[model samples]
Target: MKLLLVDDEPVALRFLSGVLAGRARTETAPDGASAVAAFARALDQGEPFDAVILDIMMPGMDGIEAARRIRALERGRGREGACRLLMLSCLDDAEHQIISQYDAGADGYLTKPVDSADLLAALANLDLPENPLDGAE
Candidate 1:
């Protein structure tokens, strides 16, 4: 699967990469603004990721806003809706932001520090083995 893993911390990024060691197409972003820009570039190149694992809190343009902007761009590009945004935050109070994230247009949420098995399970479910049209399906 094509995955974009976004976080401000290098250690977290490295940890995620290690956890997703077998998932070869994963990309990393250091902050929300760059994440949005990268997402846009991928769409422009006609090769967007299957999922985006985003950190909720960042220095600028937090993940929520980035997801919202990406959704707007998706609509402009004639895409049906925003891509699947999976929260990869360390926030214990994740439930408090569910409504806001949904409103901002996230498809799913996961808390950190991530458990490899759970992360893989969620990704596997999102990327169905029986379906090849996952990215656009």
Candidate 2:
């Protein structure tokens, strides 16, 4: 899978990328703006991400807003099914937040300090191809 991993903190971004390195083609964006830009560029390149793991809190634009915009962009391109979005936050797994994320177009949610197994499971739950590398071959 081609994954976009977005987070403002350097450590979290590095950790997520490290965990996903050999399993998928992963890209990183340090903030919401860059993430949005990267998402657009990927679409333009005809190699859009299969999933986006976006942090909920950021300086300019939060993950919710970014998710909304990304969805809009996908809709505009008529490629709404092209990607799955997973919102990440440090907030408790409250019902409201999960509801809000779904409203904003997130396909899944994961609280911060994410468990590796859970993260992988969440991706699996999206029903993506079992072997991303299969596409290349």
Candidate 3:
């Protein structure tokens, strides 16, 4: 799958990239604004991402806002819900989870320090094509 991973922290971005190393073709963004720009560019190029993994906290244009914009972009193109969004956050509270789903239109939410197993499982559960990560170690 083609994936966009957005995280403000360099370490976190690297870790996630490593985790999904061979499983997906990934593009990384340091912040929400860059992520949104990349998303737009990809769509314009006819190479939109299959999924986006967004970090909740950032300096500007947080994940929630980015997600809203992405949804808007998709709707504008008549391609709403075509991209699966997964929220990765340090906030594991119920409120955050609710906001990520209902407010930000995310397909899934996972807490920080996530392992490859949980990440893959979350992605798999998003109604994507059959278990691509199955037996991946």
Candidate maximizing lDDT: 3
Candidate 2, number of clashes? 0
Q: Which is the better candidate, 1 or 2, if ranked by lDDT?
A: 2
Alpha-carbon deviation at 73 in model 2, angstroms:
0.6
In candidate 2, what are the lDDT values of residues 29-124, reduced to their tens digit?
988889999999999999999889999898898888888888988999999867888888888767737664667888888888897777877777
Clashing pairs for model 1 are none
lDDT ranking from best candidate downward:
3, 2, 1
Per-residue lDDT of candidate 3, residues 1-137 (tens digit): 88999999999999989988888889999999999999999999999988999999999999999999999999999999999999999898999999999998999999988988898888877765443765554
Cα lDDT, model 2, residue 106: 83
Q: Which residue pairs in candidate 2 have backbone atoms (N, alpha carbon, C) closer than 3 angstroms, thus clashing?
A: none
Tell me, what's the RMSD of every candidate?
4.0, 3.5, 1.5
Off by over 4 Å in 2: 93-96, 130-137
**Candidate 2: 10-residue stretch with minimal lDDT:** 128-137
Sorting all predicted structures by TM-score, with the top scorer first, yields 3, 2, 1
Best-fitting candidate, scored by TM-score? 3
